[model samples]
Target: MCNYGGGLGKSLKPFVEYNEPGKIMIIETPQSKSAQLSACWGPIESARAKVRGAEGVIVSGNVRQVDQFQDAGLPVLSRGIAALGPREYMRLGSVNETLAIGGLKVDPDDILLADDDGVVVVRQQELSQVIESCEYGVKHDEVVLQAIAEGSTMKEAWRKAYDLLGPPVEYARPFRR
Candidate 1:
């Protein structure tokens, strides 16, 4: 019953094109009543990729479309899927509404970062700052992981993990047309 039709069905591109080398993480805004739906659908449309061309779809509420979304190789991160469609529960709700997902409040146009590890929501204003912090964290963690990989003791690696930060800067969303 759930749909991967509409824009959700197509390849999502805006996210893919916009995110570039970085992976796009979609944090769904939560729903009050049926929290499970939010676990897949969240409460908004922004989290659902445009369905034409997208980096991936991360369902905060609950997501269906296993065969549809999966067959296309669409990058979908979902808590789970139900056979019921949106019409079964709600209808005519517009896109771009504020959403709560995974216990996080996600606004429209917030910066979402993700990878094999998982997802993180960077507030619109804090996006750049977070990237700066995370980039440094990533580099340092790499070194630490490398040391451990090279037969270094866990204690030593842990000790060396400190002060591995680079300059702390800000994360600003680029001005769009």
Candidate 2:
């Protein structure tokens, strides 16, 4: 979701194309000075829908409606601020136009991975592998957390996490919307 409701400039943008969650969607409308479009998606609404329940939102583009999500503490990863907003800056440029988001090529159904660290997109074929890896990492972290709670040193906790997850998968894709 790009552009909150501020409405500034940059009119004529992509229209509402897709609404499915847990999938990657790219925007290729050229690189704006700031990929910040604002959240027209309505953060609270998204929460109600429970889109991607446990998954976080990764906006290679922009996100507005900050207050809603900010209050709820929902995870949203985007480029920058969008004072202009959607109504003014956006015009349904193209639905499913294969837009470039933060320099990442987005295709429908691509898996999106957003977390405390940041957001990243994975190919459709590679999506499963990414999810599995994330789960593995999460479980590993849990063990380390418990160890720490049990008075284990930071190094020991990290070691335990490492031992459980084996290794972390580095995201090789570059982010530059």
Candidate 3:
């Protein structure tokens, strides 16, 4: 789900209406210099999202009520937090549309995996390939770690692991040593 807007007033209804189990919500606010520094979501919205079965939420803008979001057990990733509400500072623009977030293009239904490290977007069409690559990477890492534990130098361990598994696939190269 992708929402292009500045406020949460009119947008929340449609956001709830389109709710689907296990779907991540991606919201984008206007990037103009004059845009208000108000929150796009708060504790109430977080509770509503959890009840509606949303997997998580990613806001390309601010959110408020930090403690309440944690209390509601909702995983919300936002650019920042604001004390002001959205009512006077923003207006709804669009929903379920393409959005440019942090210089990456995000479309509805794209797979978003986020953690303390950061967020990674996997296009729907590349899901299988990405999964396969990830599985292989995990196994490869284990082999390298084992070699290192057995007293092999870091470079030697990496070389031995590479020999055993062959070079990683192109997409998985960046993750490998």
Model number with the top TM-score: 3
Candidate 3, residues 37-145, lDDT tens digits: the string is: 7787888878888888998888878888898777666789888888877754355666777777878877776788986567788888888988988877887899899
What ranking of all candidate models by TM-score puts the best one first?
3, 1, 2
lDDT of 1 by residue, 48-87 (tens): 4433345666665456546554545446666667655443
Say what the RMSD of model 2 is.
6.5
Higher-ranked by lDDT: 2 or 3: 3
Q: After superposition, how far is residue 34 of candidate 3 from its true place, in Å?
A: 4.9
Q: Scored by CA lDDT, what does every candidate get?
A: 0.51, 0.53, 0.75
Q: Per-residue lDDT for 120 in model 2?
A: 65
How displaced is residue 54 in candidate 3, in Å?
0.5
Q: Between candidates 2 and 3, which one is better according to TM-score?
A: 3
| lDDT score, candidate 2 | 0.53
Q: Lowest summed-lDDT stretch of 10 residues in model 1?
A: 1-10
Q: Comparing 1 and 3 by TM-score, which wins?
A: 3
- Residue 35, model 2: lDDT of 34
**lDDT of model 2 at residue 131?**
73
